[model samples]
Target: MTKKPRLAVLLGDPAGVGPEMGVKLLARAENRDAAELLLIAPPSVLAAGEKIAGTKLDVIALRPGDPLRFEAGRITHLVQPEPAGFAKLGECSVPAGQAVLQALTVATELAKHGAVQGILFAPLNKHSLRLAGMDEEDELRFMQQRFEVPGFTCEFNITDQLWTSRVTSHVPLREVADLITQESVGEAVHIIDKALRSAGIARPRIAVSGLNPHAGDGGSIGLEEIEVIAPAVERLKRDGLDASGPWSPDTVFIAARRGDFDAVVSMYHDQGQIAMKLMGFERGVTLHGGLPVPVATSASGSAFDIAGKGIARIDGLQHAFDLCVQIAARA
Candidate 1:
């Protein structure tokens, strides 16, 4: 028999749709086939999800150092519940933040121990991260610190065909001016390079988007294209990456959507996300590149708007799982 791929599934934000969406995904037979799902959540939270998902799930609860409690068609609980926290549905609270952090802590521990093939996170709010006193950096930075991982790490969200990234992430627009340096854009190119290779793309055709309108109108509009962005693209070409552009932000995405490029590297967060979300927001799934182990992607948070409504989509989680499990097989 093919041994199942072990997955560390973290329940982010007990108050939101993480648990509920998790239950919905695990109950699908397809997930069971791809991997063995383990839950890093409090028992009460898993039970609540089971109740909300309308299934009599056999979630096995366990403590640290205990044998994995995994069972077919069930979630193997790996952590003790928080001492006290809110367990409400569809409402965000301070306690909800604490719960999400606790879940991430457990997932990281599993990663450090090499007990699981990948970390599959549900949505976790950035605000929750701050309330938990976790330094409030994005997951890409946090995971790097938590696991002591060396080298650059990046987050990419995949829709049906489009893949995207932020030249600067989780930072202020004011900071963006200073952040758009040759080094920063070069870092993005490298990330796109590594990520494309991981996603099975060879000789990736990378498209670089401009920070200013119409690629700075050939220095007729803005100098950022000439000063910062263009230098990076020149360096990329010299390094032998199939890289090109300082293209018009307006048309680069349309070009990528038409298969002109393998991935599009944008200047900021919304530049890439706005289009990806528009293409198919619910189908938008996230991926982390440059990690030694396959890391399953998810939202920065839970979507309480559809929590317990049985309408929240798990396509993101499903695709993330498929990405990790398939990679695990090759690894």
Candidate 2:
């Protein structure tokens, strides 16, 4: 029999619904059966999550520096001590940010050493991350820096039926056009194609979205489609990739949803995000592609308003875990 892939699962933020969602995800028999899970969080946080979720997990808890073991039918939790003055429920604070940083650091180290095959984290607050002193634009960049990945990397938003990636993310609208070069566009397409294939799609059909309205209408609206995007698509096609478009961003998802393409590469963040979230907000997953190891999280952010309400949905986290497992198993 094949060994199950070991995964490091982090409870996103102490003050958010991450702990509760982690508890709920682990309570399922099927999740436990699928992989050897290492649940990482503070003891206080896990207890609070069990209380909020009303579902206690059978976890073998370990402190820092303790030897790790993965037992059948049980989770192995690494106890991440809560920082002093950690934020209270639904509040963002430096202590909460420090704790999240610590957890991610440990998980990244494990992945670097090949101790874990994948990392699945719940929703985290960017505000808390910033408060904790993360200077990078986002956690994906932080991971890239920590792993020292020198090549192209991008965030992938996915649903059960469709996958989307962006050339430029977390940038202002005014700067997006200048950033959309043929090299950047080609990198986005190449990475998404590789990611989809890693997830078991043999030959992914990718549709590229244009930067301007109606894809520049043959250069009447903008020259980016004619000059940058079209040339990039042609270059990628000549390189033996099944890539097409400069498709109109407005209707790209319509074709993608109708089974026209396996994935869509967008010019900017909101172009793809708005469509994916609209299609399935509760089940969307954000995958950090081009990393040394598979890492995934729910597309949804830390819902501070709904923290500790016992009403946070687990569908997105579940999907994230499922996809992480798929990619990790392949790795």
Candidate 3:
């Protein structure tokens, strides 16, 4: 019999819908049947989530670093004490941030030590993370720093079967043009290619979106396609990769959604994110690619306003869980 992969799950940003979504995910018997789980967070946090979900959780309590034989159909946890001044729903404060950071830290360590095969986190409030002393710009960067990963790493936004990778993420729009060089574009293509292959797409077809409007209109609108984007595509082709593009950003995704390409290497964040969200906001997932251990989460943010309302959707988090399992099982 094949053993199920053990995954570490965290309820992120206690003040947001993360806790509620996590509760909903665990409420399903199928989720527990598919994989063994290690749910990390304070008991109070889960209790609060259960209140919103209207269903109590079945969890085996354990401390961090405690030895146990992980079974295939169960959820375990190392509970962190609820911090002082714990913020309520819709409040982004240091305590909420600290809880998120602490959960992520422990889950990641479990992955690093081979105790868990992958990690999945619900949406987190970036503002709270910063307030908790996370000096890095985002969780991906923070994870890279913590793991001391030496190779390339990026966040992959996925909707349905289509995935998108960007050349520059979390940068100002004004600086985007300057950042789109041949090296940068090629790197984006490479990473997306690797990500697609990891997700079981063999010989993945990739589209590279041009930086300028209408692919620079042959230098009439802009010259980035002529000067930077096109060359990267050609270079990737010469290296025997099934890559094609410098396609006009406007029309590329339409083809990708219609089954033309396995993924798209976008010039910047919003170039691809905007389209993916529009395509399937409820089913989108952001995967942390090129990490030694698989990591993923809902592409949507923490909906603080709807935290305790129990109306927050769980589709995105469910998609994240599916992808995490797919990648981890293969790993």
Candidate 4:
């Protein structure tokens, strides 16, 4: 008999569409049977989500004396810490942020200990996450600190069509210049290369997108192509990887879609994300690699703007879980 895969999931911000999305994912059979999934969440939080999403799932309390209800009825109850603050749905509250963080901390701990194969965090509100005392603006940064790894984050989107990333994310457009470096671009290339190979791509061809128009127009525009990106490509090629570019951003992605390469690495956040999202949109999944465990956060965030609408797109969440299962199998 094969042992079931285990995934520790965080029910992000009860106020957001996370609850609704979670409902849709758990309802699927592939998720229900292939793995043993444990949700690290508060009882009240889960209940609110269950009610709003209208999906029934087995809820096992992490805390003693915590409230729990199954699809048909409330099953066994356990005792748990009472989350403080207002349980306001569809709004940002300190309490909701704290709850989301609490669940994540627990889930990450489980993944770290190898209790679970992977850690899956649903969409999170960046501001709310910060209010939970995170000093960083994104989950990747927070996880990096929590795991004590530096310079190790790349978001991945997988749709019915394509997947990709940027060398820089979450920085201002004006700040893109100061951040692009040969070392940084090179690292992005190398990491993506490893990831593709691990996914079973052989000699994965990596295409790097230029920071400036027409790849610096032969230094007439900017030198990032010549100075920052090229050197990295050279190093990668010398390292025995099939890497190339500082290619023109305008046409490289189209070439990539036409089968020119396995993955197109870009200079900044939107450079890669724009195309990826356009292709993947609600279907793309964001991956967090180089952590203690292969953790994935949702492409969508706390949709406080649309909580309980029964309308949150769940392809991303489902993919997040599916990816978690795949990583767990590797582990």
**Model 3, 169-188: lDDT tens per residue?**
88789999998999988888
Residue-level lDDT of model 4, residues 1-331, one tens digit each, is 1566667767777778886777667667667776776667677766766787787766555453333233322222232344787757677777777877776666666566666777777787877777768777577787777666777577665554345667888888998899888788777877777766655677788888899999999999988888878988899888998888989998898888888788888888777777877666687788875676778766766777788777788888887787777767765
| lDDT of prediction 4 | 0.73
Root mean square deviation (Cα) for candidate 3: 1.4
Query: How well does each candidate superpose onto the true structure, as a TM-score?
Result: 0.93, 0.98, 0.96, 0.90
C-alpha positional error of residue 136 in candidate 2 after TM-score superposition, expressed in Å: 0.6
lDDT of 1 by residue, 1-331 (tens): 1577788887667777777777777788778767788878777777777777776556677788888756666667776666366656777567777777777777777777878877887777777667767783676677777788876566777777677776887788888878888988888888878777866787888899999889999889889999989889999999999889888898898988888888889998888888887777776778876666677655434877777776667777777778778766555
1-331 per-residue lDDT for model 2 (tens digits): 1688999999898899998898999999899999999998888888988999998899998888889998899999998877888579999999888888888999999999988999999888888989989998889998888888997899999987799999999888999999999999999999999999998898899999999999999899999999999999999999889999999999999999999999999999999999999999999999999999999999998898999999999999999999999889888
Please state the error at residue 330 of candidate 2 in Å: 1.3
Predictions in order: lDDT: 0.76, 0.92, 0.88, 0.73
> After superposition, which runs of candidate 4 have C-alpha atoms over 4 Å from their true positions?
64-82
**Maximum-lDDT candidate:** 2
RMSD of each: 2.1, 1.1, 1.4, 3.4
The residue-level lDDT of candidate 2 at 25 comes to 95
| Candidate 2 wrongly placed segments (more than 4 Å) | none
Residue 299 deviation, candidate 3, in Å?
Answer: 1.3
> What lDDT is obtained when candidate 3 is compared to the true structure?
0.88
